[model samples]
Target: GFADGTLRLGHLEVKASVLTHDAVPDGLTKLDNGDSTDGQAVYADTAGGQVRKVAVEAVLGSPQQIAPAGTAVVAADYRLGGTEERPEKSFVTVDATGIGRLSRTESRTNMMTGEVTETLTSSVLPGLPTGVKVTTVIMNTAADMVLVADNTGTLYRYDTHNFNAPVLAETLKPLPEGVTLTGIRFLIGEQSIVLTGSDGSVDVYFRLPRDNAKSSDGYTLIRAHQLEKHRGAVVAIDASQRGKMFVTADDTGEVWLRHSTSEQTLLKLKPADINGHYQAVALSPRENEIFAVTDGGQVYNWDIEADHPETTLKTIFGKVWYEGYPEPTYTWQSSSGTDAFEPKLSLVPLIFGTIKATVYSLLFAIPIALGAAIYTSEFVHPSVRAVVKPVMEMMASLPSVVLGFIAALILAPVVETWIAAVIISIAVVPTAWLISAFLWQLLPGPVALRYGGWPKFALMFAVLFLAANLSIAISPLFERLFFAGNFKAWANGSVGSSLAFTTLLILPAVVGILYFVGERVLPSQIYEIMRSPNRTIAGVADFVRWIITLMVGGIISWVLAGLLIGVGLDPRGGIVDTFVQRNTMIVGFAMGFAVIPIIYTIAEDALNSVPEHLRGASLGCGATQWQTAIRVILPTAMSGVFAAIMVGMGRAVGETMIVVMAAGNTPVMDWNIFNGLRALSANIAVELPEAVKGGTLYRMLFLAALSLFAITFIVNTLAEIVRQKFRKRAAQL
Candidate 1:
């Protein structure tokens, strides 16, 4: 028997071939008188005619269907008592007449009738009981006594040596008013008789040994304490062959096991939809198996088995105090070598990976998508806008798998090669616009007044192109100055070096340029909207001074943080080895590429959907184009833009092949931008096909899918709330 839903069986032994006349007679056979339990007729053989031990087995009419039609022999096993050194065992058989026994028997195959031919020995009961017919027999070979219950509920014990002239040892007293005996079993170890009566009750009669001087009969029988009974009349009673635990079956088809030492029911079973008295009950020697048979030959076997440990809740989701660990940890390792390994199936890491991917993707996509959308709607010439809008909208149709392939095979290598160049580009690209805007005003008054928005943008693009090359070209200078020949070596080896180029030139330059353009360089009305309102600060003038202070202060703080993080990276004295490649940078850029078109298309459409008259009114009232776009159109379309960003976010969160190929599939918990992670969708795609059906790993994969669903649902719900708030603000505008 197994908890994994399987049963193991041994080889079958044919009863007739093993129980032949010549073979069984030479062995220690039971005193073949019809008793109770399995009718095991014989067990062992001794060299001489002096067998010391015997075993009872082979119950006759066990299933009731096996009972022969004509004059056939039926067997029951019983103990005939033995010396202190050995216990004597035997079997009892019955014929058509009534309950009878056989001291000897011969069985053979009848050629003509094709039936087992049986011959009974004369060494049996000389005559049947007289005056009252006996219902059940129990033999106590220790005191050479035989017990019997008659039809009138009278119990009698007789000397086993004499059959015809039986010496009666006791005449039992009457029972309760309406009680009638239905079944009986001998409790050999307790020297008691267990009786199941008509009124769903069980009573025990124990034999007490008399002192040698008191009487020649040496023992007296008396009624002992009664136990809890079945709800209906019990039809069969039995116990483990060598145990004190007993079992009973009632008319209602309920079976229960109870110990003779106590009245407590250890186990109970009631099969559904079948209600009738059981004909037989047998407890296996192992104490874990029980068999019940009805009169119609219906047989049922029940077994007790234990479950496998993997399904326990503690092993699935709970934090396990794993061996060899300092503290309990939430881990999600599903399998490893060794049978004793306990699986750690924590969902925390998967959830963290999902959030990390979504966050990085959003950070990379939102600014670029929204900026392009703003340019096309508010600044671009209509002819160019028509081409720009449709082209970006078409990009939305590119397959994500193709994008993932590009990220894995192309983008990761490119980023790894120009790692510093890329970081410089983020700051450089924005400065291009500031520089170009400044350049437009620096032109001669005659030249500036002639061309409008189109020529200004062309200058902006030229500055952007030069700035991009400057960013890439300046990377080597920054590396040599601050990074001791290589930036990767500085990151992977040590912390202190010369001041970075970004620190000496780019930082102060960007700070001065942005601050001046935002306050003193641009229009005063723009300054009025952006500057602090407190008159104590003198508004715009002091605001510029404060801005310079903040920018310089912010740059210093950023450098300090970078140095601190660099120091912490070394795990031992002067050593750090893990290189940064194919990490969050690759995943962010690649997923951002996949996400930008989605966001840009939707956002441009949303911006286009806003009423054109609002823009015209703002411009007609003498507001600059930037002021009109910022103060009017953007706020009105805020809700739709938020929705577009969320849609891109959903795509980022569920992306598989891109992150799977680029994110390294490392199931670790770390937020460092240069490290990789394992996302849930990637894990599922990688593991599901390898998992066995109906196994623990297979179920865990399905659970991971469910976790992804829950994350998406929660994100969408929160996004909806923020969208509603934006919609309300747009209404006010």
Candidate 2:
């Protein structure tokens, strides 16, 4: 195995064994008699991982002549003891150049004179939560190390640099028998500490130097503010930037605002309203705002500027005047808006937008939905009804974003081009229907049966198609005929207003159409009720039409008035507001279509449930099937239809997504269908993400949510009451 062809491994081993000499200078040793030599010797201990003592001998022959292959020996010119105590009590002995060779025990040494030192003992409190142990210890920015624990409240502090090692640091005992710390915060440039305890109390303290002779604990406890408005354990605390004001919340969901000198109850809630046990509080540094979170997971933000934080309604008495009326002595004005200050989330605009968007949508959809619903439910074959209802209802479930994209992208442009055509069709198509019926009557019986009903459907589509296409094809012609120039320009020139009005001019016509459809679809009960009161069909129709017209008209007018009254209805502003308003087109469609299945299912059931003899008796009285259906079946089913419509209205008013996406996000006061608005749910959804957590915007979103919850609750309550009333009425009949 040797490259040199000399198997020298055993020769060297035998030479080393025979090389024992008499106190010899073997293994390259150097003696320092009375002179000095530069050398080093390293030794390793055979026992464990420790070192107890070391002694050095010298060896020299230039740097290259060291013996034992790698060992170096040098004279020991000086010696120094270790400065600090070691945690282990065991040690190992070493010789020459700091290498251990055997096990030994030694006392700890002092750096200055090499003397023994003793270990110190520290105590820590017990029974803290699991995983809650102290890790960091510090007094303040530059103060001595003090005990700090994880969230579970263990304590740690230290006495000196030697104590700075976490293992050597002392853990502070819990507060004396009568007290426990609930909150802790460093304050006043980190020189003072504030501690909050149970029973609405707080203590301030400052750490003094260890050499201080004043107190045994080397600290002074100062009574800062013992706040008591909180009902239970103070679960949360927050302070303003200057520390001039602080707020606290307790388990009961009560909040208290405390100044350096005094305290005030900020808010308190009933157990049911507390929702979540209060767990956290925060005060905005730059604004007069307070935020609190409860264990139940509800968060609330408050504007602390108000004296009465819990009051929902604030009103002021003011003198008012009305045109052509006696001078007003007093009028109640909402304190929410006064002297250039207004509630940030005013419900007026939002309410208006909700109504407007619903009205507009219904204007567009009711004719389609109700007309479809009526035809499908009343005249269409059973198979066709099955197909048609689901298709329409399926549209309800379509993601609103898709519809919105269509409206903003496809429909908006289409409306812009075919606006006049659409208007003309609405006016012309009905007349065409009447004229076509007259022509059909002139046909022979066989021709009529062959062509009447089926041809009517085809003719209906033909007229509509002609109107729509011709309107678009001849839009310029109509525009020239009506305005003699650009219609938008002419509208702007006449009204001296923005272009939004011109674009929205079709709004009134659309509302008229919605009003017509909605009125025409009035539940049979309403018609029966009117007829039972001796009202003729013409009279009933007129009344219902007037009601629908006014409702739709008022909505449109309110938005227009918004323009007249210094509120602009631009897309960015009014479009959003219109969608947020109540009674919007989407609301109407949702409400109306929602009534479809209910009215059909319930009314059908009620009709079927009626004694067959009643309908047979009406027929026996020589009544036609239509008359029997009207006089007996519908009259008996009146309560169910009423109940169904009421339920549908509640559902429509409360649905979040359709309203949120279709209703505009502006909170405006206009009721115009053409304008935009945000509903309570829509407002919350749109703003929740944009709102900074726990700020006014965030709390406003909550308030909107609460309002929506309340509205839905009230609507359902009212619907139930109305349903009962209708039931009683039907029973009387």
Candidate 3:
């Protein structure tokens, strides 16, 4: 029996003469007594194209007549004619009393005469009840057909050419449920019929001449062997046209391909190996391809009789486009342009907006942060450092939304009017510092030492006081000096004539000239530091003071540049405009303020960690405390300070709330400080929740996340590298 779908029988030692040219079995009869016996059958033509089954006791004797009457004898009736004298022509049909018949036309001729003797029944078929179909059928070497009945247990057979004639075929008992036939195979040289089904169903029939069961109305079906191979539902069945091989597939995607060998011969071939369970299977009608699809929507194809399945020729994504489908074919109107509405995830604008915001924020942030680090770490008094560091660090913890609101609602307005006031602050602070230093030098040396550096501090406070008071004090004075008692009125008179260009525009040119002249000659303190090498108390004070100056100046310049870029250099009259609209300094202010605590904590830690021995050693070498801090302690703690700054940078870059709330979200590419800008963290947080899950927007958000993570990673990595380098440098020293 075949593993799942087929069975085969080999040569059965039947008489050679029984293998005749008559491909169809002529007739069958059942002997009485119901036990099997045998009789003669012939392959012959009948009259006028009708086939005839002539019963011949010429060889095998009828068991019914010889033994008890109940004994059954199988026989076949093959004659020279059926209805008319057409020797070479015949018609055949299977006559099962309880089952339906199968008829076909065939041809026959008298070997002695060259003429057509009869027209035989042609395509012979099996007999079965209506609705009880021939679940399996097979044609033998003699062109005889065998069929398994679906209802009444029966195996019916017929020879070609016995059409519309009386021919009793052997009948077998019905099969049990869950035993649907799969294939019917005939061994050409064996004169046998082999039946196979889905699982554990196999039967074989072998007889010399004709069995008496062929003459009976009912015959017992002998189960030869049962096959128990496949574990699932049989999905497909196929046979080689030559009957040499057959195959079957199961719902589990396993296949059994085998060649047929008679009972004693070996007949087996490997089947195709396609992975996964299959729903439907089809062999390509044009090629050696066998295709199947699984329940999970995957399709596969394999070469016929091949060992393994090949690469997946197609996937679902490719399948969609292969049929000419477009990506992004569907779109919805996402917004109605209100506060409730948000922008779409068009790659261009979101990316631009993100870069613009981050650039502005960083442009605003870096100078102030670095400058503050240098000052607090280098110059500020211990008492001042304590207060300033905590305040700044605490500010870092402030919610960015509040800052954003202030920038949008409060700062933007102040910067606008006092744009000039803010710009002037940049020059005012330094000039004030110079004046303060001049005042400190004028103080008596003994008074300066008794104050223990309070003189320098007092000088700075007075300078700041004077500069700010002076700006307020002289603003009206300058307005009158420049605009003839009514700056706005005068400028409006000149610009209102054309509403185009005015002295307000020309002011930038004047400022540009002043700035070019200023860079050529830096502040006096920088000169003082460059000139002094005494490492004296005054030198340390000068350096710290100048460092603080640079920090404040850097912050102001950064903020001013931002404002000029964000809006313009024009000084509006509104106090709100003076703060926010005056320059891009707002971003610098926001970011710098945001990171101050982090940098302060980190820098102080680094400074505190510096070895006390180094400072003591410097002092023993006649260096003053300030000189020790500047020449020895500062350099020794430099690594820690640099680390603090780097970590603070990472903090600034990753600060989401501050940037999101503070950045304007405008997709502009300007470097202006007065304008608001976006940052990556802020953009991602703002857009992520709104993005559809698993869509382009969602993936893009993921990419942004990856980028942010990467930036932090790189910054931390660099910080570590710098820290290690510093450690190595210190160790060498």
Candidate 4:
């Protein structure tokens, strides 16, 4: 107990009679004076409106002389700043009575003599009622702002950067109608406040930015979470020195352990023999023990065993409103430079990223692998197939780390410069192949048969090469005409550019559907005439049909895109926003290169294993090789082809090194081809080494692994079920 400038702890007593000016100290705070060997304590002399400090030493054994640290003139409660290293050199004090006023004081101590000198500044804090007295003052770790509470249960926020001209930022009434405010303290990092009320309420408030027009400072206080209520008025509260845990004591003699971020009541303890109301409570420095003092001068202590109080199911899987954020969001920041940092471990973004990476890679790999397998199995000569199959199979042996390095260092920069050309080639290459095939069919019968073996394949390759180069040469002109000469800027958020880009992305599908419908809608007489034996007439008819289908499809796509944009449903704002250099496009291309060989090899083997008798029967029935392969062989081999694709998808889902190096490793949930992602595999690879064993991060990484395993197991199980159905259907043949 403290009285007459004397403080007693167990069997020890400290006297500072002269420094207190014979006034009894109402509040006391111990400070780390930056020396492990010496102790310093500050006392608030509210009656005299002064703060006093004394150096404590055990050897001296007698009452030590106390010195004046600073003065507040009408001091109520004083708290020092939150800098851990430089401890307690600056503090703020609130007025005990009168219009709301605060004192900001800084002290400098002599190293040798321990003499202290102070500089004091005072300011009137606005937003409080006219005649209310200030009761408690608390400052954040940054020390640029302070929260002052008045006797009327009103909280006022003051900007203390300019000490003489403090600005009142916000006014809040957070307590209930009949409840009085007893105490408030900042949790670790000072981004959250724990307030105790006279009606046994414990609530937490987070600093949020204001959305009102009257406030220009852009900040307000909000009640975010409330813990379990106490049985009586909560008289004393104290927070942990290291984490989000705190201890509170009520008049009913019950003490509760709680966490701020998780909003969990960890434990409750009631002293067995205590019968009086507790006046003060404290958490030990390491947070392993709790100490409470009753008004009858009795002290009770309890040992605690709480760990990882900040982690919970809601915190790991659901959206959380973290400190210093505007609203609740999915975030994955796991570590920081400061010890007071909060750990955010949401795994939603990583799972989304894993699925996204798999889908994009399969979109790039499946068509090319299957197309190559069909051509090799049905049309190529035995000698050429021997060479091509071996070479394609050898591609699977390349190292993924080497591919990631090439993609990140070489492909990303080149693609960013020619992305417009790359997109144009998607249409150009397929159209060039179609036109070349039509022209080749117009050749005389003997010449066509003579060159159809290896020469045909070589010519097709040359045409593809020429088409790619043509797109690259025309890229600058195309961008200038369609995207205002700056595709990146246009893609970011220009009006009509997003619609135009969307139209182009969906153009191929639209054109294919139109072609299919055109064939069905054509008159039978004209179709037979166009399919006549004359090569020149047939080729010209088909070319004209293709051109008409393309034009009509483009018009339909433009109208559809415009209608979507009119409804505020443009793709630009959601999954397809902002262009990033090293993004999903680059990672997909690199991982597809790693996945293609497995699919191609398996699919080609399946196609080659089809029965020779089926081919003979189709030919004997006057069916062409192309018709036989498409209608007969492909249906029989569908089950094997699908299994191969599923295997490739599994490879893409578990890929680590390639995505880690080339994907920019951002855990964002966007589906834009130009945005970066961080997959579960990559996240585990990158963060596991730094995670401490038996820590929250270490366990969370294991959970990520479990999620990945579940995804693969479920997909494979479904795939096997579908494969069996397909195989049963094929058996009837």
Candidate 5:
């Protein structure tokens, strides 16, 4: 359609001229009638600055003026209100001053005379600035929202839900200095806008809620992504009806096919390939072909092959600067309710989550599983071993989903309540065990020999049980002393509390180092005295030395923590940050419970398989039963123990239901034991059912599965190699 009211149909190859309307004195500024078959079209006349409706036929009907004269209509849009067969029509006109009028037409029929009459109603849309030269006025299909662009590069967003009292939602200046906004159009979903600049820059802008905003309707327009720049001014832009893909053509005769979400330039066609410089371009209804027409009456069509343009190696694996994010980050939000939502498909977080879950699970599982294996195989009586081994093996049959259910519904809350006690137990239980062992050595030789083996194990268990209960009883005092009565608040608060938390966390390491250094630095006379034949004297000396070591280690840790804080190294981020209830610690505990039975069973079987003669020989040489087991049996079974831990690791890596239900399923890249995580397996289990076949999310899920497989393959291969080395070393032993 031209400004002279000449309507044409068909392409350049075969064109047909439609009815030409009566000439206007100042030509038509805009023409719109929607998809109407009634031959009625509303157009804006510049001469009288009036919006007039005219019937198109062999001879055009008399112009029925809608708006009053002298009000210049700069732009107008029409939309269908009812069914296509009997459409109620509405149109809005924006004058040069940016004020708009919405007019709706309703038809009524006289039943007796069979005469049809039309009624027109008008309402003022108020919000836009007055006296500004309006260049474009666009209304969404619902007619409740409008965008007005004036000559100044500013875009006005209006909420016209109440047409007579429209609200101005936001205004945006998306262009930079010296770069004029050439045109703007809504993408397929109308939630995003494609803004083109005179400098050939194309950018996407969308509405996002302001962070911590006070108002419910507080949203700001943000420039999300910038596509490939054109060589010259972009003349035409059109978006596909089905997807986020769009086509842009520049005056330099270059056409580029781009996707909004992935920010990918799928294809580019030069002027030589298209044979014309198109001034206007459009995507076909099916989005399979692009049709473009040049001002010189030349038309060109190109087929587009852009399936899965949103997925690439870089987009899937690397950090992406997504629509509303301030910086590039790894994210994995795959699907949303709206068509305009951008898919964040990065797999880095999932992978990190898998590793974190495995490592934490192993940390909790290995010591307990191996300790139980050693005790059952060597220290415990055969009857106790017989009962314990079967019970441990039976634990492996418990379903992971059942464990996850218990963890999420019961254990998580309990652990959160007793978290301070749990932390205190880490230090208290081991120290209590050492004190109990020293006390046992102090007992008379006759009584010690009489209450050995099962009695000894029972005694140690009682000591640990008491230690655990004591830790729980003192939990409040411990929190008050170190954490200011609130562990979470203290841990996440100032540097002083962070330093205190860091010191406690590193206390065990400090103690271990001090023990090693003390063994070398302490007088030989002291060790000899601790090993004296007098049981009471040796035990008392050993207890005093252990107490002194603990106190020194605590003092050193406090100093080290202060130095770390002084250098801006607070222990409140990365792996350890703000605490949550259903977090990595709870998941680790649940997953560790699931992994322990596997590791313990395999390791116990391997320890039992070791030849009894080796143990007998070591004991025959006057070494203790503990010495025989630690020096001979453990080394010979090291290969199997290593393999058991590796197998348990594989189990943890592939765990889905447990992490899904208990881990909170957040795809965040933090190692904080108190924070939640989402693993690759859990992600696949959660999202696969909703993913469309052959879609980007479905393919990415498959890729996630492949990555899991590769991780297990590499881990098992390395385990086997290391196991072989251990086996050869055991052969020499």
Candidate 6:
């Protein structure tokens, strides 16, 4: 098996040759190929259809071999391809001072006597301390990487095949309690370092991705996993052809099959069955047969056909049975918090947070922005509208980071203090605006004409002033009635779990039935009443409509409240307990502020662009200005309005800095406006830089961006479809 052989498949053929090198007489001297004496070339290989011999070393005199003070352990000659016209090769030797590279060599002959002699030279690469002895070295010449470990249990890595520099170098850190490192092994297919500790503990450190690592940087390990139940010092470790699954032996002669990532013991071999302290362990290249030799000269082969780890659907999508928890639960922990903590990477909560943040931002932004656009575009006098529209448009240019700063620092505190007042303003502001408009409509003709029309500035001031007074008056009433005179106490209260669960199941069905009845039955009956022109009949129809609307609204509120009943939660108290300083309220307001101007500018342009003749014709037909604006102008511009809204949403979804700074960035699943959330954009801003290049986290960040792209594509496509439909409908009109 050690000799060269030939293999064939169809017309293709492969020739395998066992390489060899020069052997000197000194016992301390080493050869590139072990136990081979009839070979001539030490660094010759057929690659890319050419022969390479290290470009021929320059030597003025006979080359001398390096004889170190201590016995050398391992020497490996690697065939490498490179940034050159052909492939090359390099040899490495590990001795007292650690990895000495065999850089150049020469052979000398005395021509007079026709005698020849061969000598090897070496170069001591950088990234190792002086006066240290290297116990083992691995050269990945194909990857241009070198790893060396010293007797003191310190391991170092170089970013070059020449072993000249360190990209990131440090001693093994954060070792477990009362354990000292005893040995190191290149494990998991030469991509990780396995440190064996005195207490039978093995720690696996995956190579960190270098910045320059290109496509498919391979797999990387972030945290170190300590193998379980290792009682004695681990004497040796070996991997199967499948790098993730491996076997380890302790000084006590017990052997265990384990996984490198999960660090779970798969199978065990007892000392009585294996017979001696295992000096070496190896897995067969072609089969699942493991061959182990003990110091007592006993050889044993373990046929492990089913060494693969077991998994099921529950381990992936369903609740996981963790080691210490009493019951299985959904979790999303990524790192090992402690040595005992399992790595859990669930996606449920994160997805929920992303949707929740986006929904809150849109809900807060749309109505206010659309209303403002409508009013400014239709009602305001041209002279005033020009000034107001530009002012609103300027808001789009304000940086999001500045908006986030203000939201987090200035606005959150203000809203938190006037929390009850803020809620009450929802009712008070509209009431005040309606009352002000009524009062203005009742103004005398002479006074209105003197004021250059309806006086929007003064009208808005009256509305705000009255709304502020009404909000302050009702705020205390809300506190006394619903919040027990303490808003914060109410905000923190939780609904009972059993009640929440019952409602979660029952309410949806009830609501669906109600919706079905409303859609199929109530509208048909209402349409009959709406066709009548009699005053009393119309009033009756309006009252019925309001009644249906109120019923639907109340049921929705009840269902939302029922959702608060969750596992171990108390649902008896104030619904407002969910509010927090940097919660969805802050993010919604900040992101909405950042988005509103975009919608306003585009919508205003669309609304204003409606032909003036349409307005004139509606007015001439005895229609009120508001009626004509809504029925004619808005309908004609509906396509543009929808496009405007979609564009605003796009900005909201992609807006990063404001949400990053204002949204507390907690990846929680709850949609309560009082709780903080994490968005995909904000998550990228927060996590992307901390991730290692080409690592899982790094690739996941790109996935998040791709998800954003997909969302934008879907939204835009839908917007276009709706816009086209509205355009057709308007053309018919």
Largest TM-score belongs to which candidate?
4
Error of 2 at 88 (Å): 69
| Per-residue lDDT of model 3, residues 258-292, tens digit only | 43322211222223654566555444543256555
Looking at candidate 1, the ten consecutive residues that score lowest on lDDT are 1-10
Candidate 4: regions farther than 4 A off: 1-90, 106-117, 213-216, 494-496, 616-626
State every prediction's TM-score relative to the real structure: 0.53, 0.42, 0.41, 0.86, 0.76, 0.53
**Model 2 misplaced regions, further than 4 Å:** 1-312, 315-343, 359-374, 437-460, 470-634, 731-733
Error of 6 at 676 (Å): 0.4
RMSD of each: 22.1, 25.2, 29.1, 8.1, 9.4, 18.2
Q: What does the lDDT read for residue 128 in candidate 4?
A: 61
lDDT of 5 by residue, 1-733 (tens): 1222221122223222333235323333332543222223434333454333444335332233444555556677666576643445566677644666766666666779967676667777666666767766777777776777777778777766775566777776778766766778888767778889878999988666777533225776778778889989888989988778899999888888998877899988765655556778998877789888898877888887777877878788887766667557899898788766777899999999999999998999999999999989987778778888999999999999999999999999988899889988987998898888888888998898777767887888899889999999999999888788888886677433666777887888999999889989999999889878888898899889989988999999999999988998876775567888889988899999999999999999999999888888998996767778888899999999999999999999999989999999999998788899999999999999999998878889999999999999999999999999999998886
Provide the lDDT at 344 for model 6: 49
Reference-based lDDT, each prediction = 0.65, 0.47, 0.48, 0.80, 0.80, 0.63
Candidate 5 off by > 4 Å: 1-179, 188-192, 205-223, 252-254, 269-279, 284-286, 296-305, 491-496, 576-578, 607-636
How does candidate 6 score on lDDT? 0.63
Angstrom error at residue 410, model 6: 1.1
- For model 6, residues 490-512, the per-residue Cα lDDT tens digits are 55653222343234324445655
| lDDT tens per residue, model 2, 565-629 | 46543432333222212224434444444434444444444555667778779889867455777
Q: Which stretches of candidate 3 lie over 4 Å from their true place?
A: 1-388, 453-462, 472-584, 616-631
Please name the candidate that would achieve the greatest lDDT relative to the true structure: 5
- Better TM-score candidate (5, 6): 5
Error of 6 at 664 (Å): 1.0
